[model samples]
Target: MRIYLKGLRIYATIPRIKDANKLAKYYTETNKELGIDVTLDKISAKEFIKTAIVNFNSMKEFHFGIYTKNHKFIGLFSIIQPNYSKRICEIGYWIAKKYREKKYGEDAIKIITDFAFKTLKMKKIFAFVNTNNKASIRLLKSAQFKKTHTSLKSATAFEKTGTHISTYVLHLAIYSDTKV
Candidate 1:
């Protein structure tokens, strides 16, 4: 699936082995500052592809790559499994090192949120951001996502490192007659 915006294009990552390594490498490299071990050195392209197909076919998660007008790979956007009965989903995204602070995240989020409500028929969209991630907080606000809490649950798996987060929420009704 491809979703176009004024200055960006977001498309689903093909579930092929080649695409998997490319994405995995991009992710690990881009998020290096977070002390994550996700690296090209750790997993072979073959292994990455195997994992990618399994996750891709699970139907519980979705990963989309973001690109420029020229199709330069910049980053990613994702909509994980939703509470289907409630029509609510969690949205997350990131831009490459060079693309930050340029409103790319804002534009991409706006476009995806629009698509989620209009095409996917979602009722609500939620985002979890680290409190220290001021850029993301601002990006979500620009997209009209209301800050629902001052402290959100930790995203890291159960190590319980005191990483405080903030929860943001946006409902479809807010954009009933709007286009981004």
Candidate 2:
């Protein structure tokens, strides 16, 4: 499936093993900013690709590759650790550093949220942004996700990564901010 939004296209097909270098490069580049634990360099693309395949194929996780209208790699969006019975999922995404401030994140969120409900049949989806990550908070807010709660000293991912976090949630059944 390809979702077109704001001139950007999100391709639902997961990258193949031959695209290992591309995945690895992306991981090494965005690992710090996105709080990922992988250190695989370009040479280790195979391992990174392997992990992605395992998570995607076996864990019931969904990942989409972000692309341009012309089909250029821009970023990634992952519906991680879904609970099928609960109809709940968490969205984790990161746009390339160069794509910052381009409104792509907002567009992607809107499209993905729609896909989550209409295609995935999900009831609720959520995102967690570090309090200090003002940009992401603004992005999520602009996407119409309600700021549900803030946790103090809650994050333990990276050095100086903000502990204060705000959880933003979206519910299809209650678009008017009804209590969940």
For each candidate in turn, the TM-score is 0.74, 0.74
Error of 1 at 154 (Å): 7.8
Error of 1 at 4 (Å): 6.2
Candidate 1 lDDT trough over 10 residues, lowest sum:
151-160
Q: By lDDT, who's the top model here? A: 2
Per the 3 Å backbone cut-off, how many clashing residue pairs does candidate 1 have?
0
lDDT by residue (1-180, candidate 1, tens digit) is 323444454433423444555566666776675555556643575575465456645646555566666656677777665556788878877787777777677767877787678666888888887777788788888888887752334333122256766788898877674553
Residues 1-180 of candidate 2: C-alpha lDDT, one tens digit per residue: 323434354443454556566666666778866675766656576665566667765657766666656556667677776777888778888777886677777767766676677666888778877778888788877867787753322222243444755678888866535323
lDDT score at residue 100, model 2, on the 0-100 scale: 66
Going through the candidates in the order shown, the clash numbers are 0, 0
Residue 13 error, candidate 2, Å: 3.9
